[model samples]
Target: MQRWKQYGGLSGLFAAFLAAGYWGFTATGGALPWAKRSSKALQRGIQEGGGGLVNLGRGIVVAGPIRKGGMMLEFGGLVLLLLLLGIGMYVYVDRYGGFGDGERASR
Candidate 1:
């Protein structure tokens, strides 16, 4: 019972931290918030430029500025995703013993 409570508390704390960071960064227009704006900018760039994915014959080539912004967004998102995944895996391993009882049945 105590272990369950600890696990629950940890999970809640992680969630709250993630939510706060996302909201705070977005509100402050930080680098992380650039991810959302990238999609819109990509569309506009395609519309203005003569090259885009849809026009496969010419091959897709995003504008230099838009591409640079997108790379930053992608890198930031990758870091966040990796962080969450690592935390989740750690929680799972902690909740259920990673190396289970090997040969203690007779004991």
Candidate 2:
């Protein structure tokens, strides 16, 4: 219940998550590969001239590493988790209203 304990726990959690993210980023070849991909895409776009900005037939393109590495299921799961979290928060807010003090506002 102490404030210091709460702060320490939060700091520890943040450090753990930051380390894990850095590990993931390094293991996945970091930003170099992505930079190269972006450069090539830009050059190709310049060479190819104009086309329809929104092509319904093409659909959305998943990143090459994720698609090639077969992380689609993990990606989908993360997306679903975030979507559920957002909806849950929305429902909780709608049911309980906001944190504003109604009495203070009326004064």
Candidate 3:
């Protein structure tokens, strides 16, 4: 009999990725209190067009810290997925013998 053990780790990793993306996007402009400040700062900067607005807008983008964090989160998720798959394969092999028919035993 072939035994298949499903690893929920991948799902967990996917969820983490989704959460990180959500936080990143929402942090820029969501229900979060800081989002309001960020939005206002961005708009004001765009309007001013000069030093004040330009600097404010640039500061907002730079201060957000989303780009680098997002990349790290994505990489972490990928690693989690790989780890889960590896563990699942290991469990499957340990329980069901090898990858060939020879692994199966006659009843």
Name the best candidate (by TM-score).
2
Q: What is the C-alpha lDDT of each candidate?
A: 0.75, 0.84, 0.70
Which 10 successive residues of model 3 have the least lDDT summed? 57-66
Tens-digit lDDT string for candidate 2 (40-69): 998987998856655789755666789899
Q: List candidate 2 stretches off by more than 4 Å.
A: 51-107
Worst 10 residues of 2 by lDDT: 98-107
Residues 1-107, candidate 1: write the lDDT tens digits: 69999999999999999999999887897885687788888888789875345666764554577667768577668768999999998886666655466453333
Please give the clash total of every predicted structure, in order: 0, 0, 1
lDDT by residue for model 3 (17-91), tens: 999999988877766677777799889878977454246536423233545566656656876999999999999
Query: Which residue pairs overlap in candidate 2's backbone?
Result: none
Worst 10 residues of 1 by lDDT: 98-107
lDDT of 2: 0.84
Can you give the TM-score per candidate against the true fold? 0.29, 0.49, 0.32
lDDT against true structure, model 1: 0.75
